[model samples]
Target: MKQKDLIAVFDNDRDLVKAIGTLKENNIPVKDVWTPFPVHDVLKMLGRESRLPYFSVAAGVGAVIVTFAFLYYTAVIDYPIRYGGKPYFAFPSFVVIIFLLTILLTFISTVIVFQVRTGLFPGKEAEVPVTGTTDDKFVISVGSKEGLADEIITEAQVILSANGAVEITEQER
Candidate 1:
């Protein structure tokens, strides 16, 4: 799907929130939001559900389990090295290795999952519709559907301006 639309920029979080509230009050549809650092309660203000933390937790747990299982299988079944008269299944001695491996694998998997989910990594270029939105500003972007988009942009701009936004820019993408 292609996003063809206009985006309205704001200077700060308060202005962004006010703009979003105004849009909601006016029953205007907003397609997306962009911000510099994450603003507290922004998702709730915009009626969005957070998913990244949940996904990251799931990936970390999966990584830990897989790493532990692989190490156990390899040490007890594949290699079965009995060093210094230690038992093949010496669980206590394996704790340190297992914990270390679990952390390592979890970190690696978390990074990989984040990169894949966000479409970022080597040989991948992210499509940023508004670059300034992530620097010192926020953006309210709406896709072109009908004349509704212009109305939304106009109302959003008014709200943002009233809420103390220092600058506003509109661009068709």
Candidate 2:
């Protein structure tokens, strides 16, 4: 089922935030939000806690474990060498390589995850983006046509307008 994105435009940040609160209170899930600048209260109202940080930590840990296993197997068993009084399993020398690999992998993985989750991947065009959302206006985008009834959309528009949405536009995703 294809989904549609509905954009509700507000003339000011206050109105946008109020509309967001109204939608949430009424159980109309906000799909996305856009503003000229950061608005902590608006995000708080949305209540969507990000899982990106947790994902980064997990990826970092996984990278470290894999790097350790690789280094350990190679240095301690596969090709053991006693050089300059250092034993076959010299933990000190492996630290630099492990640290570098972990950092690199974590960075790469985090970027991939961010792009995938945010729909910012290369070649993917914007779906129902509202121009000037980065300048004079604030926007609250809602709607995913799949199972989103017309009555619900109508209700959402009414709620948004009642709360101060100046304009509402519907577009396909």
Candidate 3:
């Protein structure tokens, strides 16, 4: 889908950071940035905190709880069976399944969460201003509303190019 966003592309990381700083100084809110690799400085510039770790922890804990509950309800309440003189509600017997399912479910949930949160999925095209972003280019985008409409986008493009942006473009969502 097309998005109405003003994107400033920079050939180098330094240029991107500089453009971002300029935009911030001018009181422009950045929508997002795209880079070939993780840029720690960009995160600092954007003032965004990492949430993936917490999401991961939550996924793991949820998986363990669900697996344990399912196993206990099934083995201890649904149907009971004795094997090798072991208790029907043997805790040890559920360890392997719990461990394996926890890991598997955690991984699955993490991936699903990431994809859902990031708007990424199979066969969906990403909304980007330009190509080559995943190779060596960096892009800084500002949304086109909230006082940052066409006129603001024009101002942004001028500031970006002057501050070292290589290519600038606007898209409509």
Candidate 4:
């Protein structure tokens, strides 16, 4: 379903961040933000955080444990080899392969988890809220048509404009 949103565009990151801060202070709920480069403060202001890193860490740890367990089983139980007076359970030799596999699995799991969480896949249609958002523009989108009162929307637009929004418009998102 399409929903109407009030979008404020800014030419610089400062204006965008300032507008977000002001809107937040006014108790206005911002739907989303878009920018060519990430603005670290904006994420904090919006109370948004990503769990991808935690997932990556878990994947890396699991990979290491599974790889080490498999190596131990194969070397000691499945096929015990006593050659050159070397120990059957070689720990040092497994380090390199374990490290490599952990890295590989972590990378793959992070990508897969991000894609799944974001609902992104190959050949998916792009949803661009405004032009130049992926280039030099920063956009702050406020969902307006559904739950927000018209008075609040108007107040939000005024706040955005006062805080240096270059342009503000309403569109169905």
- List per-prediction Cα lDDT, in the order shown: 0.71, 0.85, 0.84, 0.88
Clash pairs for candidate 3: 2-173, 3-172, 3-173, 4-172, 4-173
Residue pairs with backbone overlap in model 2: none
Candidate 1 vs candidate 4: the lDDT winner is 4
**lDDT by residue for model 4 over 1-173, one digit each (tens)?**
55667989999999898899899888998999999998889988888878788888899999999889988898899999977788998788889989998899889889999999999999998777887998999999987446577788899989999989989998764
* Model 1: per-residue Cα lDDT over 1-173, one tens digit each: 33345467777788788777877787777777888788766788766756667766776677667766877899898999999898888878767876787677667777777778767879876556667766776877754455355566677677667766666666543
Task: Report the poorest 10 consecutive residues by lDDT, candidate 1.
Answer: 142-151
Per candidate, the number of residue pairs that clash is: 0, 0, 5, 0
lDDT order, best first, reads 4, 2, 3, 1
Ranking by TM-score: 4, 3, 1, 2
The 10 consecutive residues of candidate 3 with the worst lDDT sum are: 144-153
Identify the candidate with maximal lDDT: 4
TM-score of model number 3: 0.76
How far out, in Å, is residue 126 in model 4? 1.3
Instruction: Compute each candidate's TM-score over C-alphas.
Output: 0.75, 0.73, 0.76, 0.93
Candidate 1 to truth, TM: 0.75
lDDT tens per residue, model 3, 38-114? 88889998987668779989888998899999998988888877789999789988999989998999888888888
Instruction: Write one digit per residue (lDDT tens) for candidate 2, span 22-137.
Output: 88887887888888888889767876667889999999999999999999999888998889999988899999999999999999999999998987977886553777876788
Which parts of model 4 are misplaced by more than 4 Å?
1-3
